[model samples]
Target: MIRLFITRHGQTEWNLEKRFQGSKDSLLTELGEKQAGMLRDRLASQNFDLIYSSHLQRAYRTAEIIKDNREIKIIKDKALSEMKLGDWEGLKYDDVIEKYSKEYDLFWNKPHLFETTSGEGYSELKKRVIGSLKRIIRENDEKNILIVTHTIVIKQIMAYFEKRPLEKLWDLPYIHPTSLSLIEIDDEKTNVKLHGDISHLENNVKEIC
Candidate 1:
């Protein structure tokens, strides 16, 4: 059996402010750092054969915290980066709606109509993210693996394995920051669940934006 443990990076300033944090990098907040540590504490005992993370600072930092003193060498993959939001990056939630109505409307509520002006297209993001995931699966050869990535990437990966169409992506539960997901793939069957589980955070779980 193949065990795929996927998780999102910790919270950022933009996340707390409800800003669109596409490819733009942001520093993790104090709470964010704690979240990563909590997640690490939850999974530290597991024996992962390989670890991968996005090249973005937030994700890389979370991976570092998770790795801690472990000998694991995390492979930073750009393909796992979050969706680039073009001019929408760094814009506040209300600002995005008021400034870029056409794009923002579709981006939040209508994935089918969402389109980035100077960023990546939906198909492009889906293709690259899944391609990278497939490559990892092929090489790992059924060993347990850990993937540290962004929100959109994790959503897409889960959506793909769950056979959920893009239009229904939001139908699934919102994946909180530092949330963990487990995807199991094998010859006989493939299973995925716990898309946004943060039970590891104890009772101090902050609301994820």
Candidate 2:
């Protein structure tokens, strides 16, 4: 059996500002670092054979915190990065809503039909993320793997495992920063043990954009 522990990076400055990070970069907030520490403490007893993270500083830093001086190697892969938001990369939520109203609506309401002006669409993002996951699974069987990525990336991955349609991408139960999800795969069977779990954060859990 293979155990997959997946999570999103801690909250970032842009997250607090309600700005779109997408492929752009941002530093983690103080609370974000605290969240990572909490997650590190939460999984201190667990062992990971391999750790994969997006090249983004926020995600990579979170992975490092979770590693906590462990000898585990963290492989930074662009395939694990967040969906490219193109023109909306650094724009605030309200600004994006006002500037790109139609595209924003499609993104939240109908992801399958949404198209990016200069970035990747939902299908493109899913294809790359799922492809990376499949490659990882194939390369490392019967191993505990850790993947630290972004909100949209994590959500798309979970949705794929759940066999959910793209149209229902933003259903409910938001993927909070540092939220951990576990999946077990044995032979051809896949089981999701946790999905968007924030029990580690306890009362410190705060919603981010």
Highest-scoring model, TM-score: 2
Best by lDDT: 2
Q: Tens-digit lDDT track for model 1 on 101-201? A: 88877776888778766888778899999999999988887698889999889889988888888887666677888899998889758888567788888
- Badly placed stretches (over 4 Å) of model 1 are none
Give me the displacement of residue 161 in model 1, in angstroms: 0.6
Residue 113 C-alpha lDDT in model 2:
86
Candidate 2 wrong stretches, greater than 4 Å: none
In order of listing, the candidates' clash counts read 0, 0
Residue range 1-209, candidate 2, lDDT tens digits: 99999999998999999999999999999889989999999999999999999999999999999999989999999999999999999999999999999999999999888987698899899899999999999998989999999999998999989999999999877899999899999999999999989898968556655
TM-score of predicted structure 2: 0.98
Q: Candidate 2: lDDT over CA atoms?
A: 0.93
